[model samples]
Target chain A: MNGSSKKYWTDDPEMVERYVLGRLSEEEKRRLDAEIAECEPCREMLRRETLLAAGVRRFGRDGLRSRLRRRLVRERRSPVRMYQSVGLAAAVVIIAVGVGVYQMFFADLTRPTQFGKKEIVITQGGEIGEAREEKREVRTPEEKMDAPPPEAKPAVRSGAERNVRPAEAAKRTAPEPIQEFAPAAKSDAAAARSIWLLGTVVMETGAARTGAAALSAESRTADAAAPQASPDRPVTLRRGDVRNDVALRQRPLSALPTARRSQMGSARRVETLVETTGDGGLQLTIYTDDVAASELDAASVETLDGDSLVVTTATQRILYRLPPDLFTAPSVRTKR
Target chain B: MAARLFFLTPDAEILDLIRSGDEEGLVMLYSANERMVRVFVTNNSGTPDDAEDLLQEAVIILWERVRAGTFERNAKLSTFIYATVRNLWRARLRGMKREVPADLAERDDASDEPSPADALAGSEMAAAVAAALDRLGEPCRTLLLLYYWEERSMEEIAAQLKFANADTAKSKKYQCKKALERILTDERII
Candidate 1:
């Protein structure tokens, strides 16, 4: 035995056993401490017991402590910190459960009765008032109050309703007060038919009136009466053979360069019937032969009167009437 | 007092420092305790990758608990940290999404190596000692090992393993030693 083990052995057996087994009380520890300071035999015994214990402990030699330490250190630095909120976890569970329960039982409760009633109003045309009245009867007083206000309800005008078959049926059943306006209504209907026919004629004739053939006849008339006309006021009409000449002249041509003019000529040809307005600005009907296609590309077509000026592109609109010096490119221009 | 320090220290201290806002403290805390947490996780049946993930989760939980002032210090700092890691690993086990390999379930008892004197006795001697320990039965062996290896006090060992009192721990310890000695002498391995 070594000196410490021998010293421990020489001391009380109970004390040696207690210390060796690591069960020594504080008092026993203090006593051993005092005894070992003087006793070499007791010290020697302790050494032997410790060796025995050490041999027993080395059975499994894995570096579990160091591994554990390394693991602990790594865990402390992990990035999973974002998901650690218990409250958030609980809240997610609650929301999921709530949705599940709602789907299982209350799903049908959420469907609005007004949706069905609105469909009926649209399909049946003139029965909108009766449908709304029936809807009000079905709802409770509290539901009526809680429901959207009257202004929120969509107003369906009977006269403006299309699908004439349904409208005629509704009108036959309508009250006598509405019947009194039938004569006045017939006159209004006749006027609307006349306007529709006139629109078709004007659209077809405008371009034909400005053609070269018409211009030649006008020139012949002017030449026959040439000497009789006033000398001081010359009626000089510059008739170019170009398809877009009349429309181009009617626009502010100073803004458009030759390249853009040719592009406009090929991409779009405008027909205009110009009449002088009382305000001195010309009343112009600037029609594009390809109005549907050009409207898709252009910003918008605004009608001054019977004349509509179709701006062929967005950039040309910015240069309208404005001097070149005053035109700055808009900072945030959008094109679609 | 040490346990109190371990428990009472807000988990959120590092996070709060990170958020309000000390970026360095967050890094320091993360780097420091990461390995121990991983080992604890692995010991409790988590995969090596799972251990890594769980260690991060444990740290994050610690941070959140500290922030919320919810961490309760009931054990030593190391013990509490190990327990937290263990709890997280246990939760993963219960989830049953994946199988935990058998090797991870084995306890890592090798950290408590016996003293150099015991080591010099050779593997045969160590086996002899373990065989002696086996003869003492569960409670005595448990108390003896916990006393020597874990360095638990009589009160702590009694409370942990749930013996009657400190006196029970002492008597159990004496009996275990006597039993070990008899076994050793009979086997002629001491």
Candidate 2:
């Protein structure tokens, strides 16, 4: 042990760790302490080790504290408190049901029925054609919600709702039916004779109450047709890109986006849909309840306005304005 | 509803949660024992803030012990926490009692207050160490904390971290420690 110079205790890192953590035996601890007092490097090493240990301890404590505080805030916001009183929750549900029932019957009766009679005029070969009206029935508030014109029947039955094609419905209900647009006889001859079933809707305005009903029918139609076309990728239309006045009217005020509400300011709802005629032609249908000035020729191609294909029907002079890109990219159909 | 269930969770389940490193159990422990700690602290001349701080500290101590496998099951977790809180509050009260006026402390030779230089060095050292640990990150930071602060065994650390064995854990610890030392040296911290 008696060399010219003593071998430093700091040479052994394990011994230094043991000494720092107070794990050294009493004799070894005393020897190290004596050496540490004499050696400046040993003292510095010990100090750093001690600081590192304390810092790690502090870091652990701070980390735990932060996590605990965050969890506390989250727990406070959690809905666990809802189940604490089942009676209060039941009472809330009951009150909601009562309000809904009152609004459905009593409130509806008090509301002024601005129900406008609508007629759909279909034209062929870009010539002014007659839309012979047949059996007309007084539309219920429910029918008004659907906003289907004279030709389109309210498909009240769930199964019938699936395929509520206005042209087909008109043919079935109309006694002296207007001539139906001929579908292509075969896929090979599809390009030659394409039929464009242009529907012109005429009506009088009073459309504030049909928001929810309009959305349900519109969404259901979209959902039903979505699988047949573009089954892999769903189509997403930007606001104002495709507008359904009926759906917009039926929409709950709070449910409408701020940007949408601003866009629809002072603009009347004109429901329209563009269906692919299988042979490259487009079947455009318009549904509206706004009062018309005069019935224009429905068959005239000149009726198709700029961006908006404005068709003043044989009865109602209703203008249907569409987004500029509607005809160019006609995949996403709007609900009328 | 879950919060109510947590309040009713037995000590064994709470301990299991601690062992599993679940913070939910710690939260439950913090919440369930809060009233008792507050009552005790307030009665003993402590403020609500003091009670909260003491409770957090006590819960942390319990967490550390349980995680490190050093906590004895002889007493309930709440009992251990309460005892720890009591000890901490007593120490704080003693420290308060030892406080002297600045002038008296300067005159008194046996004062325990750190010199300005020592205080500055201590804070700087703490800051540097913290910075180095942060830079180290991940399993390295946690491994060092488990070893140095929590004083967990290599085997326990291996199991917790899903390492192969104690030897692998020890080797990893060595590598992590060297990496930490390099960061500290690069940053002129150690």
Query: Of the candidates shown, which would achieve the greatest TM-score relative to the real structure?
Result: 2
| Model 2 per-residue lDDT tens digits across residues A95-183 | 98887556433453222212133222222222122222223432222223333334442212010011112333344434212112322
lDDT of 1 by residue, B25-70 (tens): 4345645666787666566655678765665544444443443244
| lDDT per model vs. reference | 0.40, 0.51
The candidate that wins on DockQ is 2
What tens digits encode model 1's per-residue C-alpha lDDT throughout A154-264? 111111111122334354544221111111111122111100000111232343222212223333233221111111221222213211111121212222222223223
Please tell me how candidate 2 rates in CAPRI terms. Answer: incorrect
| The candidate that achieves the highest lDDT relative to the unseen native structure | 2
Report how far off residue B6 is in candidate 1 (Å).
14
DockQ for each model: 0.14, 0.18
Q: Kindly report which residue pairs in candidate 2 clash with one another.
A: A203-A290, A204-A289, A204-A291, A210-A250, A211-A249, A211-A250, A211-A251, A212-A250
The global Cα lDDT (0 to 1) of model 1 is: 0.40
Report the TM-score measured on chain A for model 1: 0.21
**DockQ of structure 1:** 0.14
Worst 10 residues of 2 chain A by lDDT: A155-164
TM-score of chain B of each: 0.39, 0.72
